[model samples]
Target: MALLITKRCINCDMCEPECPNQAISMGDEIYQIDADRCTECVGHYDTPTCQQVCPIDNTIIIDPQHIEAREALWEKFVVMHHPV
Candidate 1:
C-alpha cells in the first residue's frame, strides 16, 4: 500500500529525499505523498523510506488509502504520470 503524509509533518525535508519513488513532496503547509507514485519502496527498498526517515511517529501513514499490492500500485503510477 501507499503511504500518506499527515499534518504531523514538520517540513523537516527528511522524508522527502528518503522516498525512493520521489512520491513525497512539500505541500502548502505540510508534506504530501503522491499515492499513485508511491510504491512504499516495494520495488525499491527493503522498507518504506518515508516511514523510516520520518521522526514523527504515525505522521506518515502507510496503506492509508489501502492499495496493498505492488502490481496495482505500479499500474496506478504508470497511469498517473506517464510519458505520452
Candidate 2:
C-alpha cells in the first residue's frame, strides 16, 4: 500500500530525502506522500526508508484510499525504476 503523511508530521524534512522514488515532498503545511510515485520502497529496500527515518511516530501511515497488494507495489517499483 502507498503511504500517507498525517498531520502528525513535524515538518522535520527528514523523510523527504529518504524516499528513493522521490515520492515525498513539501505540502502546504507539512510533508505529503505521492501515492502515484510511492511503492513503500519495495524495489529499493526491504522497509520503507521514509518511515524508518521519520522521528515522529505514527506520522506515516498506509493510505487506505490507495491500498495495494505487495505484488502491485513491486510491479509499480519495477515499472518506475525500469521503464521500457
Q: Which 10-residue window of candidate 1 scores lowest in summed lDDT?
A: 75-84
Return the number of clashes found in candidate 1.
0
Query: Which candidate number has the best lDDT?
Result: 2
Off by over 4 Å in 1: 74-84
lDDT of each: 0.78, 0.94
Error of 1 at 34 (Å): 0.5
Those runs of model 2 whose alpha carbons end farther than 4 Å from true positions after fitting are none
> Residue 59 deviation, candidate 2, in Å?
0.6
Q: Total backbone clashes of model 2?
A: 0
Q: Output the number of the TM-score-best candidate.
A: 2
**Per-residue lDDT for 2-83 in model 2, tens only?**
9999999889989998899999999899999999999999999999999899998988999999999999999999999999
